[model samples]
Target: MSYPAAPRRSAVANAIYGLLNPIPFGFFVAAMIFDIIYAKTGTILWVKAAAWLITLGLLLAIIPRLVNLAQVWITSRRFSTGADHVDFWLNFVAIVAAILNAFVHSRDAYAMMPAGMWLSVLTVLLIAIGHVIIAVRYSTDRGYNHV
Candidate 1:
């Protein structure tokens, strides 16, 4: 049996992915920090705004990342190995966590939920780790540099 060749991504696309991929995580961390402050001091505006902004950013980033993942998957035609696998799942979890943080946990400012705050923080950590793994892999992987 034969499989389709992997879709080749342009260097610009790879660079764009590398650059913009972590932005939502930064926003997520900021939002979580704001949420924690709100919990302590009873301020709501910044937390709400941060949460919404991170949500929007996550939604935007997920699309291109998904496309990238599809390209990777088509190239490999099997379960991802090494950093690629880890990056994929970490990103997937982060996206889900971001959604939960924005829609479920972020709905109210009057009551601060520990679960939401922690989830957002966890999402940030996951994204950071995933990015690090990918960056390290990219530095060593010849094919990654070619793109």
Candidate 2:
């Protein structure tokens, strides 16, 4: 079955995505900072953990939509750019980072919920599977190759 071409990466979208790209990264940083701060102060660990979980959840939810838009951009005939593997890799990396942050944040001295720890591990595994999907699909495309 054929799919519609990906829309061009508009200046607006580019700017937006570019700005948003730091989110996962920032979450990682924030998770670390919060952990260090709270671990030292010995207060509000649960609150920090909650914030980290919220960030992780938001990143997981929004990344798919961004990736879909990127896929459309890559598949579009007008762009003539067939390789979306790089975009997929970036998504994989971002999700992996977020998951790592979640895992790290869940190890707090205050209270580490087993459910959150397991969920982060599952998210990491799922993102790895997504990497496999990108690799398999791109390998079959013949028009794309690993860089």
Candidate 3:
């Protein structure tokens, strides 16, 4: 007996997904740097603005990603496994951390500093690891070039 062929996404859809894949990570990194600067410099308006702007960008990027993942699941009848799944979870964790960080920052409370800073750090580290995993997978897998 033969197994059914896997559902295929359109080339345009795949290309869009590829183009958007790294964007949130980029924004996360920028936001993390700005947050660190704000922490050190103590409430510099521009730094805070930059961090918030980048965080918003990150959130915007996440919407397309979630849609893409949903499309994949709808078409293929299964969620991705291995590296793709790991990347998804990592992004989820980063998004949650960003939201928490934003909440703490908005409160403008001194007592929240430790929690907010820790969440920011966690977000950065998770995004960095996720990026590294994607890079390694891209380098090692020739098949991804076709996608």
Candidate 4:
């Protein structure tokens, strides 16, 4: 007896995903951390750094998102796993949060205040959830079982 093979991304898609997906994650995480530091230190530098990091993350995120969108939704619907779908939505919301945070950061450092910090926190939280969904997609060797 054989288990049905789990729907999987193509090697090229996987490579593209592996390469680009983590970039935004790192950026968002760094931004969040910087936001926290800025909150504590009240330093303009940290806030400026956070803004740049968030902007860069959003820009890099576009490539993989477009590619994944083409593969997962446009090309064909071969994916059976729902995790990617959940992740997509989570990341979408996260990106929006990051965008808003970016605009907030554009204001005077002191003015950005709690709202920018909160937005950064929220963005990182959402992206982390999305990452968890991808991480949990294949915890077992057998992707799925049939009875």
Top of the candidates by TM-score: 4
Please give, for residues 1-147, the per-residue lDDT of candidate 2 as tens digits.
576754555666557655664455444444445544554576675446645554765564475446456645554436533345454555556465555545555465456444444444454455445556656765775455569
lDDT of 1 at 23: 72
Q: What's the TM-score of each model vs. the native?
A: 0.75, 0.42, 0.73, 0.89
Clashing pairs in 1: none
Off by over 4 Å in 4: 140-147
Off by over 4 Å in 1: 1-9, 76-81, 139-147
Clashes of each: 0, 4, 0, 0
- Given candidate 1, what's the lDDT at residue 62? 73
lDDT tens readout by residue for model 1, 46-74: 66766777777676777567656764676
lDDT of each: 0.72, 0.53, 0.67, 0.86
Whole-model lDDT, candidate 1? 0.72
Give one digit per residue, the lDDT tens place, for model 4 in 26-92.
Answer: 9988988998999999988999999999999999999888877776676645663588678878888
Ranked by TM-score from best down, the candidates are 4, 1, 3, 2
Model 3, C-alpha of 13: deviation from truth (Å): 2.2
Candidate topping lDDT: 4
TM-score of 4: 0.89
How well does model 2 score by local distance difference test?
0.53
